[model samples]
Target: MKSRMHKGVSLILGLGTACTIGLSSLEPASALPWQQLIFNGVQLLQLSNISPQQTVALGQNIHQQVKQNYRLDSNSKTNAYVNRVGQRLAKASNCSQIPFRFYVVRDSSINAFATTGGYVYVHTGLLNAVDNEDQLASVIGHEIAHICNNDLINKLKQTQLAQGAASLAGLDQSAVTAIAYQLAVDLPNSREAEFNADDKGLQYMRRAGYNPKAMPAFLRKLVRQSSAPSFLSSHPATQERISVIERKIANGR
Candidate 1:
């Protein structure tokens, strides 16, 4: 399993608890035997060529269904505030060219997830976890980076391909939408994807004039917790992640 871990990538959002307990270093999560057989990790992926218009359309469909199912924060102020912060980083994004929209989920879990076409959801628990705007930006920027880099899109592509759907060429629209939500809540991504998100998120923070140190600073807080955070824990290197981000900040990246 160790040798076959880098099969397919899953940008699973809010994947419950991480398997590591008191783990000190980062290591890629070993793919399940089944995953190893069918999936290809993000590092080795050639993403689906679903058109930009199709992606946005699919995203809108997914977004609408998600809003209906998730207990979203109804406070206009909170939603507007998150949207403002998100748009700033969205502008700083390098690869994602879509109009990003941010929403607040009325949950008390320290989690956040992104899906296709520039939709980002932040948990109220995650909101309260951040000590300041910079930290919040750190979280938001990370999610934005996932969208910018098309992690979600690639995950969907991998799933479709693994199941022999290949592309969105003729699949049922609702099924594709369901997979997006399923991946967000159920899968874990590659360590490479997390590193990419951290790197790009940090860059977005800097470009948006937010303190980039907040990336590691916030992750450190999570690690100090009695239990590891799923967001940082999905990949084993919470400590290593902090070090990498700190190095980036130190080098003015």
Candidate 2:
């Protein structure tokens, strides 16, 4: 398949892992192709050069790093609410077949971010910033759009771990940390990726029954906030994002 990797997704989140023995050792049934495998009752995919099993393994490994560094919010009610909203948007997304997972970080920063393998993190401050669930959906949807479009995977392809790093086998931890840091704190999405995620995320929220205006509204709010969240610092300019999203909404996208 032709790669559709784009530049409209935010690259912010923790990703690391040292375990891949389990995933790499599994052998597909004789009746099935090597690219297809059933694990823990989930069907894996092999989109582009990365297999779905590798994707999940990569996600789990990074999740371990995130767990080590961040306190995951355990408020069942709050976490459940975020997951519910996320699932709704996932169902409306183009890559709905991918099992999307959402988690809440205990940090007070008004931000949300995603990494490869359908993992998305929403900060506690972000939960407090949104006026309603629709706005929250917009944020989550944008992150999901990034994963669906394989934006981060493309980023990995350009990094030192460019060759089969998704397998998480024999990968250098220090290198992974460096790449993750660059993604989270240094690398901003290309202007095209920002616009594409905004447009796709807006559509996702709206298709999932949210007000289409919520996306741009939330972006505008971020732009005007006295203490703009780190999210703005790492994404395309908020004003430019707002303009593009508003134009798309006005044009009936």
State every prediction's TM-score relative to the real structure. 0.76, 0.75
Clashes of each: 9, 5
Query: Per-residue CA lDDT of candidate 2, range 140-218, in tens?
Result: 9999988887666555544322233333433243334435434532456656666778888988987899887888888
lDDT of 2 at 168: 41
Candidate 2 segments exceeding 4 Å error? 1-48, 160-186
TM-score of candidate 2 against the unseen true structure:
0.75
C-alpha RMSD by candidate, in order:
10.0, 9.7
Predicted structure 1: lDDT: 0.69
Look at candidate 1 and give me any clashing residue pairs. 7-39, 7-40, 7-41, 8-39, 8-40, 8-41, 13-184, 26-236, 26-237
Model 1 stretches with alpha carbons more than 4 Å out: 1-47, 166-171
Best by TM-score: 1
Q: Over the stretch 1-60, how does candidate 1's per-residue lDDT look in tens digits?
A: 011111122222222122222222222344232112223322222233444555566678
